[model samples]
Target chain A: MMNTKSLYQEVILDHNRKPRNYGVLDHPSHHAVGHNPLCGDRLDIALNLENGQINNIAFQGESCAICKASASMMTAAVKGKTRSDAETLIQEFREMAMGERDLNHPHHLGHLTVFSGIRDLPTRVKCAILPWHTLHAALNALSSVSTEADNDPVQNAASHPEALNRQANS
Target chain B: MVSANATLAKVTPRINTILDTDKIRADFPILDIKVGNKPLVYLDNAASSQMPQQVIDRLVRYQTAQHANINRAVHYLSEVATLEYEHARRRVQQFVNAQEDREIIFTSGTTDSINLVMHGYGRKFIEAGDEIILTTLEHHSNIVPWQMLAKEKGAVIRVVPINDAGELDIDAYEKLFNERTKFVSLIHVSNALGTINPVKQMIAYAHQQNVPVLIDGAQATPHMTVDVQDLDCDFYVFSAHKLCGPTGIGMLYGKAALLEAMQPYKGGGDMIASVTFEETTYADIPHKFEAGTPPIAAAIGFGAAIDYLCSVGMDQIAAYELDLLNYATEQINEIKGASIIGTAAHKTAVISFTLDGIHPHDIGTLLNEDGVAIRTGHHCAQPVMQRFNVPATSRASFAFYNNKTEVDALITGIRMVQKVFL
Candidate 1:
């Protein structure tokens, strides 16, 4: 198990205490609410996309320190990046949280690697990943996302929109 | 820090000596194991308790000496297994003080027991326009089954609201009952808040209206003595795992008349007298409900768990746990930013609290670092969470085996959680 000390380091604590970009965007082009039903953590991600580049992003919700810190760091990491670059960061963060990618290997996680300790706690992985998942949903124009494995229609629709479309048509 | 230590030292000596808690702790082998470098302070008894060696030995004895499918053949092992299983039923009957052994039906767990009643009695009796009265304090197991029944039968479900103190609103509960009220199911104790509800009075009121009531005793049975006859409840359900027994086995104590009147929940071997192509005859009462080969070993372990609890004496257990609760509550109340959600006048050894500016999940993860295990979530009682207006609360539920020191560890752990966040 990763040291709990390392897991709740000063950087993560600072982000949780005073999360940056923490508010609703004014008439955002994209918005989604992320829900972790297992722990009752909810995150609202709203961002404005201008000319295929992320302009302004803000998050506000009731979540644990890990999730709040993740959201805070996530908003900072992808503020000025293009949509594709933001998606790549989301993918990398997911991999890092799930222990799919080794930190020793070259990656673009940057200072967000502070959350690398989350992989040791299976229950808290969703806490660290919910923000990224909501960001994914917001970018795709999905209104909501849930971490619940069984009833996550948002995940299915996002992963296979054509399949969902076919079903809806049928 | 010195004053805190001094206060703890003063309280430690005052801990109720009713149950030799140290001796009781020795029975549960898991209590000795270390979590990381620290000793495990397990305060999550409301979720599931650790089993004692006595119950473990009983399971081993049954599997090694008397392992066979019950009621199948005239073989020697079958008779022994069948006898032991029935003996376990008698133990359960005595445990809940049910009138007869036939009143106790072995179920998979408390959820299965509730679902069985919903299927057997609910599907058969409840009709459209009828109402089933439930409480906001109910676990999902007690609520969802009735919901499914209500949806299928076009029946309505009326919920009893709780006060801010987490106690059931008795006047509101009494008012919810009317001519349309058909059934009532409520929790004996709030698992999320540890409020010991006034169920006996509610049951009496339900009886006056001729509406049967089912008490979800999953949280109560582990703490106090529950006499179904004394309470006059129509049905009482609880899980063995909560009482330091094996999982996958629980008891549903229904009044014999109700059990006999209800349709069979499941149909298979052992629950039938005879089967034919055209007609099938079902067995009587308890056998009628216990369809397939039951969890023989788990049931036996459950009986052993009952035996162990009885030896410890439920009254003594209750007294000792109350002392622990008092100490823990006193300590937690002293914390600056922590606020307890459920402050009911009557409660078991459960404290659900939230630290200011820190979520319960964060509190739980940090506490685990100091080897303190607590439940941090909705606790399968979302209605209670919604009523309290919190996403979730960190809960520390105490069992008889837990001592004042464990409670102190939990308090220290909470302080550490605050420090980490700070």
Candidate 2:
């Protein structure tokens, strides 16, 4: 009751209101889609990877303000950064969203600190972090296709063929 | 002769007395509890309504006293369970105003009910060129079964479009039904949009074309009176749990003649009369469809629910619910950047709305803090959400037990969401 309004800080609202990297960009390179089937949130992420650096990024489709703003911020943050660094930031951001780290007590995890409060509510956790997950999956898929790297999938889904089939379909 | 305490009671009066909000609140024991450090204001009735003590007690009573498999038994417990089980079927017949008791066949839920029809009827009658018509308002439950059936039988699936208000284009639906249209199946009430579709009209239109209709009443039965005979629908299906009955119990009411003609959906113990291994004959209309052991205890509980609904009367329930629906929609419309997806003039309490910028999942969580529970996301109507060009929607569905106070709480929840995101 102590003004939950503060959770929607100016930066967050600004990012939502007039999102940077908004609309679909021309001649996209790394294009991927994110689906939140539970709540029907779908987003398409596209960007140009100039050499190893994510140069120009853009997205299309619709979602809640947090997801759109988060996507916007993500695209802005990753532009001009190396793919390796972007990958690390995605990991760090995931940790912050899981409440392992607080924004006030963090280094190397700068502006992504805006999302640290999302972990307080378990259900909303997915909404707050869907864009980040999408980015990671898209980049991972991009990297997998680009370099044809086969990383070890630490978790085994051998018992569930239906789930594997679903992933395959997705 | 009027007493102050009785007047102040929250429980709805059995007699024709005006309902008091405070009194009505006391009847539901769970309403007084807290979730996330806030008093629970459950508005997720479209997903499932909270069970009343009467329905819960019947379940317990069945488990304790009459815990025996019904039908094909000669023991005392079996007699009692069989009496109760058949009584449940009679109750369901009365609930939907079906012509005969034998028309009701117990199933898992609405989804299973639709599958029963598709596999049984669709397999038998529909050919390669026949079509099954659905609308954008359909839940995935109503959509997938027909899709599967069409795929299996070499039939096609045609979709009816919806306008900006989330109302189905009935003209388009009528247009889709022609010589090739073998059957029409649709949601009587939209779980996501809350549009109380004109199933009676749909039925009449399909009938003119000699096309049988199967209406998914999962979202409809709780709020309105459904008379299969009056509606002239070929088949109707609903889940008992949505109407305060136990989960895993539902009824598929098929016109006896159609059910008799359709091939048995599943062939097994109860559904067979004689088996020669080469030429096996199916049982009667209902028994032919029921196969295996049905949820006897849950069916008994469902009977209790029917009794409870009758006590309150469907007409009165429908009137009060319409009041709540109008109030909720009116208040939500006042919130800027909040868009209601389904604007069908005739609707139930289901309100699917989206705040311009906030994710529905976030809205659901913030609303939870205020003790108002609503369903968020696509609500299993992902295709419908896609039609509206939105990712998801925060849905609040109401029941007869809900009132202005709960509706007020819902508004306050939305305002809080607005404050948080805006």
On DockQ, the leading prediction is 1
Per-residue alpha-carbon lDDT of candidate 2 for residues B1-422, written as tens digits (9 for 90 to 100): 13322432333445554344466556567778998577788899899887778888888998988888877889999999989999999999998999899999999889889989988898888889888888888888888988887888889999999888777888899889778988888889999988889889888989999989999999999988889999998999999889888899998999988988888888788888888968888889788988888888888988998898787667666766777777888899998889888898778878888887677877886687788999987788878878887767888999888878889999988988878765
DockQ (CA atoms), all models: 0.59, 0.37
lDDT of 1 by residue, A1-170 (tens): 77876678665557877788886654567777889999988887877798989988888778888999899999999998999999999999999999999888888889898888788899899999999999998899743333454324444446655533322100
Give the TM-score (0 to 1) of chain B in model 1.
0.96
TM-score of 1: 0.92
**Fraction of native contacts in model 1?**
0.79
User: Which residue runs does candidate 2 get wrong by more than 4 Å?
Assistant: A1-6, A18-29, A47-61, A72-82, A95-114, A142-170, B1-24, B162-171, B275-279
Candidate 1 chain B minimal-lDDT segment of 10 residues: B1-10
Q: Give residue B118's error in model 2 in angstroms.
A: 0.2
